[model samples]
Target chain A: MTVSTALPAVPVTAALPDKKNRRGNRKNSTLATVLLLLGAVYCLFPVLWVLIASTKSSGELFSTFTLAPSTHLFDNIGDLFAYRNGLYWRWMANTALYAGVGAAVSTLVSAMSGFALAKYDFPGKRFVFNVILAGVLVPGVILAIPQYLLLAKVGLTNTYWSVLLPSMISPYGIYLSRIFAAATVPTEVLEAARIDGAGDWRTFGRVVLPMMKSGLVTVFLFQFVAIWNNFMLPYIMLGDDHLYPLTVGLSGLLNQGANQPSMYITVVTGALISIIPLVALFLGLQRYWRVDLGAGAVKA
Target chain B: MTAVTALPTETRTPRTATRRGRRAGAPYSFLAPALILFVAFFAAPIGYAAYLSLRRVKVSGLGLGAGARTEVWAGMSNYARSLTDPDFLPSVYRIGAYGLIVVPTMLGLALLMALLLDAGRTRVGTFSRTAIFLPYAVPAVVGSLLWGFLYLPRVSPFTDVVQMFGVEPPDVLTGSWVLWAVANIAVWGGTGFNMIVIYTALRAIPTDLFEAARLDGASDKQIAWRIKIPIVLPSLIMTFVFSLIATLQVFAEPMTLKPLSNTISSTWTPLMKVYRDAFVRNDIYSAAATSVVIAVATFAVSFGFLKLVGNRAFNQED
Candidate 1:
């Protein structure tokens, strides 16, 4: 009877503000919807330009309507392939190897280090973590020159190792893994594993590893994309055209295009093709990356 | 492979240290692979470059042989020469000009988009947001390549469309417009990440704070400026720092685009200058000196700006 009396008065109390809230929300939403569509169009325009541009023939590329589609993508790709004995294929493969293999190894290294740092008690742990943080601030570009010289000293320059070896450290990846480990892995479970006679290595490999998988995947993706997008390190490291990744190989072609104006079509076509795989990968993996990546910028 | 070779500890004695010290070994052990590579590649090279910068080849008798040319102390001469070189100033000036165009436009678009996303009324919000961020996955080299071809008179569909109106298409790769052309590429590639950063900070905000404003009949723009912007100011500062750092290191786009344009010099950027000195000129000393200069400039600018901003960005953590 007391609750019934309180509810009839409560409904009137809520009703006035609810009416105002609905009006406010309706106004806010319509304005938001228009703004969002405009922002999306600005973002998508360049991509649309490339798509339509890629379809046209060399002569039609500039001659046709900017948004109009033509039928030359297939021929443009054929031309791209025929150049330098299909060297573009080599670049694609090289990119996959560098990013795919390097990110995988880097993620594993970061995961183990992060797990140990987060779960285990150790001396100088603070110092180690701080050092990793320091490494993060130091731009990778500064390290590139020295890295090149060092690799050259060991006769590693012009080889794939020149690019792959340095990328595998990823201080940032380790920093991320540590955060992930702390958040995802429960302390009591690991302690129980140790008490149950499981070795440290076994516990990490079996018990902690599975728990850190999602975060580790995020770490791997970050590193993979970073390595794939990396231009300077690979640009400076590899000299052998045969060893060039897509970036270096494509840049070489662009350089040659200055003298041969017609090669512009080929470059545009290649750009369109190159983004296809990663765009597919991004769309596929978008759901898993809802976590705040800003907070996740690896401390390295 | 690194996975196999780096596995299996070289020394296994059931590693022991004090509780505080025990974690020391594991991080170092995990970091060992990175450290070894770091030293071999990063530290050693930086040291070598510094060492090289302080020394130069003393060529004797027309520099006939390896013996005739000896590495001797150049002692600030290469740095002095590099500093006085007139070519260096224009690169700095150009970057300043380029940064002026890019930083504001990119961040402005990012903030606007982030606010819209936070407004939460748009359909396919996820799809749109992801599409905007898609270019982030494309490498700088790839991004530049895409834009480079689009800038071509014969290759630009926009040019085709513009020409249909009977007006000549603008030459983006030409003088004056080249900066915009390059700046556009940076904007395209960078806006997504900044949007994500800004968007993440917005998402992290407690929602009930806005519920009151809604009751007060606040417009979405009013809520964004009066409420959201103030709340995410720190993230903005954080983004500003990162964007500043990234802008200084801009190299590959111009470097890649240079092959297609005569306007981009061999020394179009500070980093590019370093590459040319080291590899092209075989002046490792000069390259080292230039790199150290750029690195110092980077740190100085960042720390100095922090001081000017009253040191708030990094104040709380310490």
Candidate 2:
């Protein structure tokens, strides 16, 4: 199903000869190593700080050394869980549902649309593609207010559909899927499927989807992270805290931290815990995060 | 394949005609979902925003009953008010300043890190790449909160270290420094993603090109400056345009930081102003006008940048 499986293989050593480059690049390599390490430390600083900060009780948070770790990690999690009758867990679950379902549906829609645009020579293809390209440029935040108003007219605002529906259509995902479709799925295979009496739907299901599997993973992850990280759409749409995603919930929690300093620990703990699932997902799918913005431009 | 080719000419022609007929309708069926959603979400909202921007609520008397507060044509009045609103211009200026600070520094660092990573002379490549890109996984809200705490004097290691040296650490969450403090969180969160983008483009370049340059006695820096950068210029331009667009829509970071800081106002950015106008002030007309203005300006900047750069990034689509 992966794109690599479709390609002819080359000898491994010829493709990646590691020993030769290491011997001559030693001197400058040290400087590059140091600079990269510095960048890594800079990036990791706040994350490390948050980890330590979350372990501190509200009292130790301000009084103790900034880097000092404490034994309040479990207590902080317990406290965060107990806050407002396990609302934090609700937010976590809502975020998962929103991201997981939204991305899954969005990916499928993108795949279908992309496959049509790529494989079939339909009327208005250029216009359809151009419109979607323009969609990619539109500032999504600008659309939030109008989306909210329009949804409210139908009384769909403040509901889960308000957030989930908007998250479903991603122009960028469709655009990327088109590129993937053109690159990975061969016309010959599709033609073969058609000759064997497979319908268009069957061809897409059996032939196209599996071939674009890796590329679709990239699109799914992009949309997943985007929906997971989105603040405005849900913040503007949903009023019920139970329907709130982690971003909105945690933000509201920090807003409360202004009145009660103790809420700061809860916010910090919430922030720390919220990031773990995404960070794990990100790391696990590290190799698939190949994003080349100039991909179409380069080929053309 | 053999079966398809071995079919009789008359039979094949009829089947081909039927297949062509089916193919004509197939793409539309496949595209139905995306098109429906696009019209409902993207096209409709934009049209409604534009329509609402041109109209306003006309209160006949005390504005009490249903018929009393009727919607009517306001023409350019809402647009005029939005443009002339005192909070609007300053937010624009502030965003201008923020973008000026964010786009270059972030992209510059991204390009540097990408070049370094592509150099293949580095140690702990995986660790460095992972660490730098880690911030991307953290939502802007959480990233802002983490930095918000880091900016607080009582809990900041920077403040602690400065006190150890008998020097006062400047408070980052107050006065004008808060702007850069917010900008710093953005740069920190954004750089890694941009770096990975540029690095992906760099990896796409053929290795023999670099091998040829090295054989010609060109240093790594020389190869990067003269060859690699020029080659990835398209990606750089694309990233720049995307970064510019993102910079204009700054919201979550500042909103998250509001609780921790005194300086960031309800109208700190243009989007925030739109939010305040629509929800807080209950003025949808003006909000719609401002949203249109922001959307138009984004289109202008994006198109203008693309045109300036020969529109190479998207010209390939045609």
Candidate 3:
């Protein structure tokens, strides 16, 4: 920054940000690199540990260095797959179902609510949005027991809906959606659609939905990771082991590791297995991770 | 769909206003699902909690039969007991200390990582960003599980790596380091989202701000501290409030770590106490009171923090 100020004829883009600052940028970048690497190590170490530990046989798990990879990789996964009628796989599928389906529906719900809040000037719009603001502050723990009881009233407790239903309406998602709708979807287009005799629903489906795609993706990922990582809700909601998501399942396995030490290996293996898809999803979908979700639609 | 229609000086314009009046109902219809869910899952729970907090079953002589106990109004006794409990205060203090450690460091690391990523400086920014965010994908339980194993003497690579140097790995899940262990899990899970948020706000800053700052002979560090940080302070506050709220409700990591360590208690944090009251002790009344306290504290602290910072990002209504 200072170099650009100090120099007269530096090409702006290639502007040596500040010749003196060049040294600073280099130092800062180095510090930044090291800090980032430290963060990466902090994050990746445990994951890396799990990866390596998952490969070791139960015997080797406690006998050797933790980072040393063993040849029992396939065996550990095979053992995990074989355990309790392949409940591990069921948990994985259930997690995918929870996160994937939950996020999709959540995104739709939030999108609709946000669009309404942003686009329509309704009598109770302010009131509704304020309620959402309050909702955002309400902790999930407070709702868990009540959600269970409410679902129990409808005889839906322990069912997938108990978990899925509560997750569908994310206040944060709705908040983000409103911001996106207000910023991106111009009122003129909706008015034009109205002038062309398109109904509100039709216009929303055709014109508004497309404009909201990017923001919706962010909403989807947020809800996706949230539901995927959620432990307590499903832990309380689902009783059947078959319905257990990875978090609850792995935790259960870890609790058993207290008594049966071999389960530690399984828990380690399961932890590694559980993280694979989400990490892959996060990495693969990096393009969709709009740093500015609000900005995504601004271009539209 | 209001338009300044090219109209003659109309005798009356109530038609457009009436049309808008009729259309106004449509937005509520769209918002109905969210409202219904909010009422059912959010409002009703809170209402129920508060209601139940005021009532508790009192058993008579033997404390035996179905009708032996009757729900009676306990007034604010439950709240008083919960508030005054020795365990409660320490848990709050622990969470305060934990929050102090987790919030700033996590947000700082996150902000720095975000700015570095945004600067497009290094080759591994994308990789490191994803690696850092990878924990976000890992559920707190799973992250705790992974970290818990890493902290174990037998499984820790640090244990083995240091054994070569004739030293044991520090018992991270014990002693003062336990806080760091829990905070580390939080930092890992939280930093990415906060980073993304602060990054979003940073990205929202008009480039002209940077261009002008650059023209002022500001260094990149100065530009970040002066221009970027101030511009994104709202985001920082937003993340801070969210982190503070989340820290208050710290649950899974410690709960998972409890099986691995003797250090963590059932009431390690406030919500953990709430969980114990709600589940283990089957004392939802006091649990409800604790929940109310936590919710109020969150609102008050978040609101106070926002007011202090004068950040209005969360003040949006509809």
Give all TM-scores, in the order shown: 0.86, 0.94, 0.89
DockQ, 0 to 1 scale, candidate 2: 0.52
Best candidate, DockQ: 2
CAPRI level of candidate 2? medium
Highest lDDT among the candidates is held by which one? Answer: 2
- TM-score (C-alpha) between model 3 and the true structure: 0.89
Runs with alpha carbons beyond 4 Å of true place in candidate 3:
A1-29, A291-300, B1-22, B164-168, B212-216, B316-318
Q: Write the per-residue lDDT of candidate 2 for residues B42-150, one digit (tens) a residue.
A: 9999999999999999999898978998999998999999999999999999999999999999999999998887776755566777889999999999999999998
Which of candidates 1 and 2 reaches a greater DockQ? 2
Model 2, range A152-227, lDDT digits (tens) per residue?
A: 9999998899999999999998888888788778776876787787878998999899999988988999999999
RMSD values, in order shown = 8.2, 3.9, 5.5
Give the Å error, residue A90, model 1.
Answer: 1.9
> Candidates ranked by DockQ, best first?
2, 3, 1
Each model's TM-score for chain A is: 0.87, 0.91, 0.87
TM-score of 1: 0.86
- Mind giving the per-residue lDDT tens digits that candidate 3 earns over A1-300? 121122222123322433333223532357667777887887788888888888888989888877788888888888899999899999999989988988998888898898987877656667788888777776777678767766787899888888888888799899889887887788777766656656667778899899988778878988998899898899878888888898899889988989999888888888888888887787667655544432322222
Model 2: how far residue B281 lies from native, Å = 0.4
